[model samples]
Target chain A: MELADEAIRLADLPAADRRTIMILGHEASGIPSEALDLLDRAVEIPMVGTGHSLNVAVAGSLVLYKLAGLL
Target chain B: MELADEAIRLADLPAADRRTIMILGHEASGIPSEALDLLDRAVEIPMVGTGHSLNVAVAGSLVLYKLAGLL
Candidate 1:
């Protein structure tokens, strides 16, 4: 899934055992509309900082680690 | 701690309650020797991919989330 505000928290995803594919888009604009349409769900990483969001790479890795149950 | 071959796993760190400060440096060279001298330990995020290492932002964010115990 892609990152979005209304999406579920990455931590709240059902289980780590299920294979998953994560789509990370541009840091500023996010995934293209066409690509987003192909995905079934989106996930968000809750942040308390003033920054707009975490870097794309950082966001992607965090999701991967969480989905892998490594973090 | 910085990323290193012999460092402990970020997940293996003692507890999430401790306050921690993470220093992330250039993706290619890593934390400079001067800064490395001041750090007491290092932690690693094991990878199964062929990539040499993760992007600096990704690595840093992962560490931060782990330290925060939010992952």
Candidate 2:
């Protein structure tokens, strides 16, 4: 289990079953360090525009696609 | 300029700049046939969960990723 950064621009690794994605909540400040430490690797979706992130369902779907190699 | 069905299990085509993705709104009805007719092709992200679709942004990201050959 390795702690990997999830910052999209910086994350060069591809998504796998062992990795996790942490999209921050609007009200929450950030991911808890303890939780982050537990993740094997952190993954992110590279995005653009004024929006921060997509709705959770869509994010999860893409992650699944990445893990399943559908895209 | 060919109208294509977006049903996940049925859609075998990949996303491209010429294609479009139409995620139904929570309260809205399906895409109007006229609009569908305008789209060269309709693409869908295949999912196995009870959820029907991902948020528009995430879906869009995945579509762009496919076209860009990121995945």
Candidate 3:
């Protein structure tokens, strides 16, 4: 719970209080700019590796687990 | 924390008391038989969808986060 002020961990989110929706972008180009206009917030998985990004399915799965309080 | 009695969740492991190692298998074939001979336990992610399995990298990443107590 002592994370940086801006870092909102998925595990710490109030999953029971509200419905959650996740939008995963294309691994290479990411979500189109227009789609970005409809989202309420952005959530990013913290990574420290050299890979440019995680596979889109993997990213989506992780978020789903976190939002579902399964992780 | 009231998971199935047979389930030993990564989050419930005593991470602070011991070192943890994770071995990821090939995406298609999975870990070799010889390699399986050495591991002490098998952990599986519960899934409900029609996909046969998760992307290997995603599976590995999820385990790492759980073991690291970051999930």
Which candidate should be chosen as best, given TM-score against the real structure?
A: 1
The candidate, 1 or 3, that scores higher on lDDT is 1
Q: Over 4 Å off in model 3, which ranges? A: A1-7, A14-20, A26-34, B1-7, B10-19, B25-41
Query: Per-residue alpha-carbon lDDT of model 3 for B1-71, expressed as tens digits?
Result: 11223446544543334676777776566667676667665565666569877767777777876766656
The residue pairs found clashing in candidate 3 are: none
Model 2, range B14-41, lDDT digits (tens) per residue? 5455544544323234467767666555
Total backbone collisions for each predicted model: 0, 0, 0
Q: Which candidate, 1 or 2, has the higher DockQ? A: 1
- Taking all chains together, the TM-score of candidate 1 against the true structure is 0.66
TM-scores for chain B, listed for all candidates: 0.72, 0.57, 0.66
DockQ for all candidate structures vs. native = 0.52, 0.28, 0.47
Clashing residue pairs found in predicted model 2: none
Task: Please provide, for model 1 over B1-71, each residue's C-alpha lDDT reduced to its tens digit, 9 standing for 90 to 100.
Answer: 45665679876765456666777766678778888778767787777569987776677777777666566
Q: Which residue runs of candidate 1 sit more than 4 Å off their true CA positions?
A: A1-6, A14-18, A25-41, B1-6, B14-19, B25-40
